[model samples]
Target: MNSAVSFFYFLSFLTILSAVMVVVSRNPIHSVLYLILTFFTLSGHYILLNAQFLAAVNIIVYAGAIMVLFLFVIMFLNMKQDQEESKTNLTKIAATIVGGTVFVILFGAYRKTAIEPFNPQTYDSQIGMIESLGHMLFRDYLLPFELASILLLVAMVGAVLLGKREIGERHF
Candidate 1:
């Protein structure tokens, strides 16, 4: 295949592998690292799609800032390896059924929609520029943008609360 296609596949593989690792890793620190790798791979995909602004934000916001905060919270909490727990067979079966149902529903929903062919010549390259993205975010999507920021703030506050130690608790 062409170089671009090959690179896309490589990024996709890395993204999927890291995402799975994030889910399966026993150590929280290792999971967070894998999650960062997944974010980097996603940013690479955005670059390949020619959404430079998105790629930059993905790296700066997710990999740079959010991950730092996540790591800080993890360290501050002084988390330990979780105790092993086994799920009953019925619980596992129920989870699998629920997951399969959700997957089938999502697949059917997307299958009904038609994908448009890509046309590079007619694409508005300026649309993905920082200036244009800023204008759209501030002018057209101001409410949604502000809402997202508020949501992020609430999440951070929640994280801090969760990480805060209770009085008289042993550090161990």
Candidate 2:
């Protein structure tokens, strides 16, 4: 296979492995780490698809900011690893069967799509550049962008309110 195809397969394997580890790992921290790896692999895929801006945003927003917040929350909760698990063999078998079935279905769908190779001439290379992105954001998506910021501010206020200790509460 050519390097592009080989690289695609390698990234696909890494992304799948990390995603599975994220769900299967017992420790929350390990899961978070796996999630970060998954995000990185996805960013690599975005880069391969010539979406450099998306790759940068994915790394900065999800891998950096969101994962840090997740780590902080996990630490704040003071979670410790425990050995209390009760999954039976039957449950494991069923879950595996279901997961395998879904994977097969998705793979079949992907095969049917028969995606074509990238063509630079047919695509607008400038679309992914910062200037084009900024123009699109301000001209077309300005209202939605401003609303999203407002929603985020509201969420921050809500989080602060929820985290605030009650005046009448007693601590041990």
Candidate 3:
């Protein structure tokens, strides 16, 4: 196998492991931290796929900005450590049955799908640098881009409003 394929497999493993950790971790803060690690590993996979611009954006938007917000919220909340609870025998049996059913469904779907192997030669020779991405974003996706900015602005305002403490009722 080529280095690219090996690197892809490594990144896939890292991303999946971290994602599982994010879901299974008891502490909310630890889950968020593991989710950040998963995002970073996904960015590495994007880079390996020659989508450099997407990788950079993923790092900046997910690993850098969003994770900072998540950490800030976690710290502000001052969350306590979670206690482990033992599952009942009946509950464990039901969970195992459900999990096995889902796994079998997914395995059957995978087997039914026709997956073509990757061909490196099919990759476009043009570089997906920031400049090229910017050009495409401006030319093709300008409206959606501006809408996303507006959506983010609204979310920021909502977060501030929700976090603000009300002292007294306002009089006209």
**What tens digits encode model 2's per-residue C-alpha lDDT throughout 1-172?**
9998899999999999999999989888899999999999999998887778989999999988999999989878766666445567988999999999999999999989967787868877668767888999999999999999999999999999999899999888
| N/CA/C clash count, model 3 | 0
Task: Return model 3's CA RMSD, one decimal.
Answer: 4.9
lDDT of 1 by residue, 17-51 (tens): 99999988988788999999999999999888778
Query: Against the true structure, what is every candidate's RMSD?
Result: 4.5, 3.9, 4.9
Arrange candidates by TM-score, descending.
Answer: 1, 2, 3
TM-score of each predicted structure versus truth: 0.71, 0.70, 0.65
Once fitted onto the true fold, the runs of candidate 1 whose alpha carbons sit more than 4 angstroms away are 76-82, 86-94, 146-172
In angstroms, give how far residue 18 of model 3 lies from its true place. 1.1
lDDT of 3 by residue, 62-85 (tens): 889999999999889876665434
Q: Which 10-residue span in candidate 1 carries the lowest summed lDDT?
A: 79-88
